[model samples]
Target: MMRRLLTLPLIGCLGACSLTPALQRPPAPVPASFPVASAVPASAPASAVPASALGWRAMFGDPRLQRLIDLALENNRDLRLATLNVQAARARSNIEGAASLPTVGLDATHSRERTLATDATSRELDRQTGVNVALSAFELDLFGRVRTLSEAAFARYLASEQGRDAAQIALVGAVADAYFTQRLADEQLRLSERTLTDWRQSLELARLLKQAEQNSSLDVAQAEGQVALAEADVEGRRRALAEADNALQLLVGSELPGDLPPAVSLERQPVIARLPAGLPADLLLTRPDLRQAEQMLVAANADVGAARAAFFPQISLTASFGYASASLGSLFDPAREVWRFAPQISQPLFQGGRLRAELRLAEVRKSEAVAQYERAIQVAFREVADALAGTATFDRQIEAQRRAVSATQRSLELSELRYRAGLDGRLDLLDAQRQLYASRQALLDLRRAEIANRVALYKALGGGLHADSDDAAAAPTESRG
Candidate 1:
């Protein structure tokens, strides 16, 4: 009996040998290189410091923006929830891992029984007490089902970590985008306020000229109309500023302090450093969403192995070691010692084709994961290419807009001068003023677009996150417009 007990270890060794299929990584369905603009500076080598290494501070030139980014990372509800999901997944993986090992439990019991008197026997009673350590329904993993499931769960835990990284990257990008918008709103408010002041001065001049009989009531009415339009613009800008402030507060996860520092004008906003348009395969692998998808594939592959194992026979073991006696005082007596050991195997000869269906389901899930993984890669590739193409076009647009603003400025001056000399009408002066205003606003919008494009590119390139070793979200990409 002792010898047979010793053989249990050898039985375990045989039982644990895996029958699962060999694992292979799915091929990435992506282009060999990124579609980028010719103007992209190729001076930066592929091995240059990744944006993930540069902290958010290094990416943002403005101190105020840096503070906001830092605060958001610490307090954003979405980021906090993502981190919690990682913890939950890890806990679930741990629970799955325990299934591979036998569950040992301690048990103690006492019993009393009485026999009724019979024709040939007197009444009798019996009492017994016992204590034992028991192992229950432990699957021997003969075909690696338990181990395969554990491994799959572990992969899902890892995937959750990558999901967190993706969330952090998104949070960083969102805060930056919102901050840029608020700055744009502030600049517009200033522009409108200044324009309103100038319009008021022009209105006053018209009134004075009309009083002196140098201008007619028509001039006063036109000047008054321009002043009213400028006032409306100022009011509209004030509303925009308020809305922008509310948006910033929402992203920050708390109310902003009144003393928060002012931002630089849109034109003076610092640019984020550009990543190399080209990257090595390893660098491309840094995207968290891609890695998450890959992990899902890994988990699915392991599920297939577990499903296959289900088609084979299962081995289970149950055992107990204990002491028992007719009386409580003798429970520990040497002769009272007892033990049991049982090993069983069951083959699924008939289960209404349930095993077959499960196996097919696992295969289907694995195929779906493969397609999802590939799709993530494709999306990542397109985002990077779009950002690259947009950057070059934005530069041209900004230049053209600046030139247009300048031309309108010159036109406004000429219109005012010709009107004063009575060579042009009031309508021409008003039209020139309107053109200059529109051009300046357009120029500001273009600048904001260029800045936003940089943020988008940073996200597309996987936010410089490296999930293999680092746990925290990698530092932000350097800010460059």
Candidate 2:
């Protein structure tokens, strides 16, 4: 009988019927195609590889940024917690799956008894020893109750894995964004320091003119005011730079190392300038959060099946095979061979409508899962659309701002030459200087925004998971769930 339990044919007969309803994926609650946004041009060519397939290293060329991302993926506390959750879910799924199988064990027993003899008032002693292979109470799963619960647990495990992936993607984007912010702060600080130096020189020249009786005290005073403003700006920029550094360090999960690669300027940051936004429906496949939500729905659907199976009879088996004898030497003797088989069935007769309530609860939870899945899809669609809309517009804005910076610089040069040659008062030169500084600052901010938008679009499209495009094709399928 123990040998028979290991036979493939008998094992295959478990959970023969599944009460789970067929799963039908809900239609996406958004447009088939994404709306055309001003950020992305109509004529722009889509990349040969979608952003989802492109690795973060390929998208962001800066070595320093790549290193930061690597550190975050390895050391970030949130991502580590997410990974642990996946492992725990996998263990739970294994436990649920094991429910459909028998729990076989080895048992041994030794006992001594003392009783009165039947023929006389004398006592007798007896000893018995036995060894057996036993099967504990194991559900037969004839109605698929255990199997459906196992399926639900497995689905939840898959959902947790996807959640881990989502966490990693978010971590990558955050590291990149913080790095860009730090670089922006660095640029602004430098600009402010340079402006302060130029303003101080102008004040010196104004003072000289005042002493020579060539300019009024008002000129010197105005120059002093401009110098004061520039000094304040320099201090403000320093504070911003320090804050940016702190933010970047937090995202990197540790203090930055001194051996990092040279920082790149905002204008020359190596991030990909444009990312292709595919059709909205593609989000269902690319985004991990969407996949996680779908897996949750699958788990809920399986729960309903398990609940329905509760209305049927549950069968279990318990048995033992071995020998029992009064002497230990005869424990394995053929004459002492003994076997026991017990099969039991439980059919719920009355439980005050508890089973019905449970079934109803499962059904309602399934409905909620459906709503949640659809909402996730809708939110994903909106994010991708917003990122696409900003793509081309950021490019145009940066270009226009660059030209403004150039125009102001030229105007400043003219005003400076005129002031030195006594052709114009110090007021015009100071105004030109102020305009040039403002324009340059605006240009730096626009550059940072453009870079930040690119990062957002990449994240929105579900990029940053794979380090190689080839791995995208090898990603796991949903058949296991």
Candidate 3:
């Protein structure tokens, strides 16, 4: 009677599982056009970026930089953590997939029992043994509950994979930024030391002239002050160089090579590549963070389906086959054999409104995910616009800084000659020297900013370090060709 009662609901649940509602994707709010002007110059042509290409090796031409990126990818702790996250997500997805299938197991048992006679017919001792192979406590996913859960898990796994790619891109950008900063610091340090040496020589000459009564004591004092200022600048630059070196080492996840190649000259201007003016919407499909957001939204949608499915009845099946006897030798006898099969179903008829509340909660989470997806799109658009604007402005700034540096250099030479000829005061020469140094530093800074902006642009366009199905399709053709 009890078995029949359990079986009724199981049949009903199986019937309900067949009727599934259509799953819907939350609507995305995409603008018709980017809000900012698309005025990138035609001088820079759009470079073709392959989806499967990753690492700084191909993007950055420098072999040393490629080595650094490789080291970072291997040893960086954050990247390792991201890798572990992907593994965890994959394992979770596997676990979820297993829930959709029936489970079967084999069992074997032997037992003995002894008891005092409690009644006239009671036995004094008992022994039993059994062996069985059957399905047990397997829940049938009649309402698509397991399927929905598995889908959510799969999306989460994809998100984890994208998260790893995001980390890799960020790591590459950081290494490049640090490398440029280090080079700039080295340049400043060299300039300071050279200036300091010149100041020392000038000071010695001033002292000699003063002793010969050819110049005043004030001239000697002024020369000493110049030497002190140059020395101070040298010390400051040295500290900056050390800091930059440490930062680069940290990014590479190791100490700088003992024979680390000489620092690249910051003065060498990199040719900025022109990217495509109007990118296709599909370009963003490869952006790791955007892909991650989309996956999360997909998972949330699946959760809603799973939660809704929970409102229906749940069904389970259990079966067992075994033998038992008072003596171990009789356990395998035909008369001792026994079998049982039980099917069960449960309905949440009343739970203080808990089921309704859970369904509402799932809906709320799904809504939140939709909002996040939209926000991610907005952020991505803004990043691209800002990078484009920066790239445009940086070109003008670089040209202007170059001109300023050249003019300052000429002014410094003229001022020094005037001072030696007594046509200009020592203060004038000092001012010109300060102006020249400032202009040179500013030019270095501008160049670094320009390169950094290019990096940002690449990141914004989702050009760096990505993998997708398109890449897979292209691989075979390329190999064959």
Candidate 4:
């Protein structure tokens, strides 16, 4: 009996060993090369800068902006949720890993039973108690199913980790963008208030001239209209400032301090390092979203392998060694010793084609993942292109707007001089003032757009939140809670 029992485990081990040579991995889909734009200069090498080197601090260069980014990284709700997701995935991976190992348990039981029986020899009453220890449902992985599952789970965990990093990058960009926009609004408000003050002084002059009968009632009406327009602009800018502040607060996941940090000036060009003139296809390998998509694809592929393995026989082993006796006091006695070993093998004869269907589903999911991966790459490329286009256009627009502002300022001065000399109507002066105000507002808008474009480019290049060695070292110590 001992030999027979020992032979069962040997047979199971042999069966598992036999399946090793048959295991095969599915082929990975080859991705096409990324299309490059014709406008990129040939002199600019594609490998000028690496994505990891494009830190937000280096791109933004403002100490105040850096502080805001730090605060948002610590406090942003979306980032916190993403971090929790990473923790959850890690826990799940741990759980799946444990499933591949045997589980041992200890059990103790006590019971008293009474029975009466009449036999030819005697009548008897009986009682029993027992203690048991065992390893149960210890599946023998004959087809690498457990390994495949562990691999899939590990891939998913890694994907979640990358997702967390991506969220951090996005959060940083959002906070910076909001900060710049608030600054632009503040600048506009200041300009509008100044214009309004000038308009008010002009209105007083117009009233004096009208009382002296030198200027007509139409002059007073036009000056009053200019004052109203400037006041309206001030109000509109005030509302915009409030909205920008609210957006910043939301990005930081809290109300801003009453004396919040002042906005960084978007008028000053941010010092961003030169970007790569052309990008290699392999440059995208480090992108978090792309990596996440690839991991999901790998997980799906592993699932297919596991599902295919499911069609084969499943083998399991259970064994126990324990002591039992009629009385608790005698449970440890030498004669109470007992042992059991069981080996099981089950083959699915019919299951309504469930196994086959599952295999097909996994394949379909893998195909979908592949498409998603490709789409992510495409989107990344488009975002980079859009950002580049925006930056180039905004640069030219800013110059043009500055020239327009200069011309409008000159026109306003000439109009004021002509009006005072009685050579031009008050309406001409008012028109020039309006033109100046519009040009100033346009300039502010262009400045904000330029700053926003830089932020977008940083994101497109997969900068800001990098998974450096420091991040890796901190990851294990950082608690989700």
- Candidate that scores best on lDDT: 2
CA lDDT, every model vs. true structure: 0.80, 0.87, 0.74, 0.76
Off by more than 4 A, model 4: 1-51, 114-127, 258-262, 269-273, 277-283, 327-334, 466-481
TM-score of each: 0.88, 0.89, 0.85, 0.84
Comparison by lDDT, 3 against 4, better one: 4
Our tally of clashes for model 4 stands at 1
lDDT of 2 by residue, 1-481 (tens): 8688786566576556579998888889999998877655544334568888888888888889988988888788999999999999999999999987899999899999999999888999999999999998988787789989999999999999989999988999999999999999999999999889988988898899889998999999999999999999999999999999998888888888899988878777777766778798887788898999999999999999999999999878999999899999878999999999999999999999999999999999999999999999998888887777778587777778889989998999999899889899888989999999999999999888878888888888999898767786577644423
Model 3's TM-score against the true structure: 0.85
Residue-wise lDDT of candidate 1 within 59-92, one digit each (tens)?
5667788778777877899989999999999999
- Tens-place lDDT per residue, model 4, 1-481, is 9999999898678445422122232322333433343443333223235544555666676777777777788789899999999999999899889988999999888776655566546556577777888989888887767777887898899889889988887898899888888889889999999999989999999999999999999999999988988888899999999999899889987766655455466666454624552453443554677678777877877787788778888888899989989877888999999889998999999999898998889888877877887777777777777776764466567788999999999999999999899999989998998899889888888878877876787777777774242443343322110
Q: What clash pairs does model 1 have?
A: 59-479, 271-479, 271-480, 271-481, 272-479, 272-480, 272-481, 273-479, 273-480
Worst 10 residues of 3 by lDDT: 472-481
RMSD of each: 4.8, 4.1, 4.9, 5.3
- Where's the lowest-lDDT run of ten residues in candidate 2? 38-47
Better of 3 and 4 by TM-score: 3
Candidate 3 colliding pairs: 17-142, 127-326
> How many angstroms is residue 386 displaced in model 3 relative to the true structure, after the best TM-score fit?
2.1
In angstroms, the error of model 1 at 15 is 4.1
- lDDT over C-alpha atoms for residue 171 of model 2: 92
List ranges where model 1 is wrong by over 4 Å: 1-19, 40-48, 111-126, 464-481
